[model samples]
Target: MTYEPELPANSSPADAASSTHKPLHHKPVAKAIHPLNQAANAKWVPINKSFITLTRIILKSALERFGLVNLAITLRCVTQQGYRHLILVNDDRDIQIAAVGRVEEFIISTEMPMTPPAERLSAAEAVTFPVDFQGQRLGYLVALVRNPRVDPGDEIQDHPSASDIKYRLNRVAEEMVGVIKRYQTRYRAIYVYGDQCYWIGNSAALRQLDQRIDTLASSALPILIRGNKGAGKIIAARALHCERHTEIVPFIESGCHEWEEDAATSILQALFAYAKGGTLFLRSVDKLSGENLRVLQAFCTQRTLEKTTKGHAESVDIIFSLSRRDAELPASLQRWLSINTVDLYLPDLRERQEDIRDLTRFFIRECALGKEFDLTESAWQQLEAFPWTDNVEGLKRLIVQLSARAEHPLVDRPLLEGLMVSLD
Candidate 1:
């Protein structure tokens, strides 16, 4: 997994994490790594946002009822270099305290807490209550007691017995598991291919685009597609091609920069030939040099010219794209383009904000390969607020890291903040 720049010494969480196909409890783990000591190899995924939030809500209610001050949830992570460590997932803030001594001792100690000295525990008032489930370790729990029992070793009466605490923790953990399941169900993807990604949502913008594609798919008219980077212009072109021909056909993609003045003739000839009875998508016509623009101008004008003059093939569906940010093409060029091709403006992320959640779910499904994933509401807000300057392309890149960084399926605000801050 990738990491951001080393977080400051005092601010980061200790290392530990988890994953599973069917309750994938990881293998053995190293005790704990110093905040400064994030190993070169650590297999980690962040806990889901919902999972973490639900966990905190339930765990806090249950544990605090009996006066426990803090806890640490450690999950196992393995490195590509063959190292193992029980990376800490929940931070001190989430669990409510450092419990530093207890966690560190639990991680490193082979012996049980009863076999250890007072200093091995946190503040000597904390005791390590540990559990292991389906081979995954529940490292320790710390209960801070202010008053001493009359005969402390004989039978402590203040807090619930260890069995009662275990019962409560078990109930809380089970509840969190339900949260994880819900997340997985909610975010599952219906469309995964980049070409089909924009079609995954049901927003009005998407529905209109879908309708437009249907109306124009078989018309064989030259067309223009406009969007920011990764906004799925090429996907639009592909959709047109697929709708027109049920069978697979050639779809050649080239940028306007490739339309050299020196070779415009040969390149156009080659592209149309290769795309015969198929589609040729040329992007960024606005990027063409003035001389090159004249060549495209002549070409489009001919496409609009009478069949009495030499003209390009009727079978080739040639499409062009321009950045929506670009100023409009010159009047004469726009006139011919308007006469010969339909203008199709792609909606920007801002315009399509309503579809962000669905698209993110689909992309995460693609990245996580069906592993359950959940993000907190704030994390979802962070995603929506992101400029997505690179559009769908940038969103996918961010999700790949987001999926791998969490040891569990849940992605919370802090985990996302760490990643987003690094992007700046």
Candidate 2:
């Protein structure tokens, strides 16, 4: 259920792609996001006023004008045939990106300004301006003014700062477009390395994990990444490899459960050779049989690259990812994995709930394909309330589900149960 926006299809920003690993920026980031953020910007509706910080600030400044009490702007979706509503009032309420109709309703309810300035401003206390860019009517800017006692005239011309409001607002609309462009390019501080090895989130847990990843990437020690059946462990390994190398390096992942008794040693040796001078991720090694585990332990202890026929002492970083607690792993394998090894923990979605919003935004932007779609605040409330025990991967799946069911752009509270969420 991808809803089209009134904007052109976004292209990847040239500066978004990075070769090395980077930590997420805690400060305001530059106008550089990888394809991920650029992609999300299409579906990236502003959830709060701080979204387009500079634009909102300038618009708020306009609100500081004496006569004006409310300001609303409707932006024509660039990719599709629709509009987006933005509102700024002289209050502390942070508004979300609303639909075209939503803004119209608010304007009508308050008798605020709307588009196509009514012919002959008689007894009118409001002004409406078309937000135009490059001859395109992007949307409308409406400002509702309370009659100040200074002027008894109902006409806008009677206000001392009428012309000033118009001039400053027009300037604001101009700056709005520029600021939006900047935001669309770089709204997130995500660190990405290809599709498989990028981390997203602002959670302390994630940041701490990142510090650990950074610390371990340089070491030659074997790593045991234990997570509670969630996501990002392998991705963590990929990030580690990325931090360890500037050039493209082989990153191989094989499940330990797939190893058979007859061919376990052969498969192990093959994986090592294939990922020489790179990283090999072994998933769920706790599932390996005791005999196969011993096979691995012996092979890892004895074999250096120099001992083999094709060996030159080539180093391969081995990372083991399992979905169990350290205590749960077989004692023998655990001893082998723990020997002078780094133990990295991947927190599941439940532990990193704080990052859910950003994760949802990222996934929506990726899946929505620049369409003007929405999950309303109420819809979001329900979504946030659901415990996604499956982790970030589960949240992604749910967003994808919602995207699939959207008949139009908006997914509101009433539709949540029937349309997307399914506990069974």
TM-scores, one per candidate:
0.49, 0.52
Q: Give the TM-score of candidate 2.
A: 0.52
145-196 per-residue lDDT for model 2 (tens digits): 6454433453444454678778866865765554443232232222233342
- Supply every candidate's count of residue pairs whose N, Cα or C atoms clash at under 3 angstroms: 19, 10
For model 2, the superposed segments whose C-alpha errors exceed 4 Å read 1-197, 304-313, 325-327, 418-424
Pull out the clashing pairs in model 2. Answer: 5-79, 5-80, 6-77, 6-78, 6-79, 6-80, 7-78, 7-79, 40-365, 306-313
TM-score of 1: 0.49
Q: Can you tell me which runs of candidate 1 are displaced by over 4 Å?
A: 1-198, 218-221, 303-314, 325-332, 369-371, 422-424
Per-model CA lDDT versus the true structure: 0.53, 0.56
lDDT of 1 by residue, 1-424 (tens): 1111111233223311111112221221111111222121111222444344444554556545555534444333333333332333334323422332222331222223333345335554554454443234534444433234422453445556657666655654444333332222222111111123324444557656766766776554678787778777866776665555433345566676644443443345455545555567887888777776776667655544533353333456677888664447788767766787787777767567877887788778889766778899999999888777777777777888888787777789888888876554
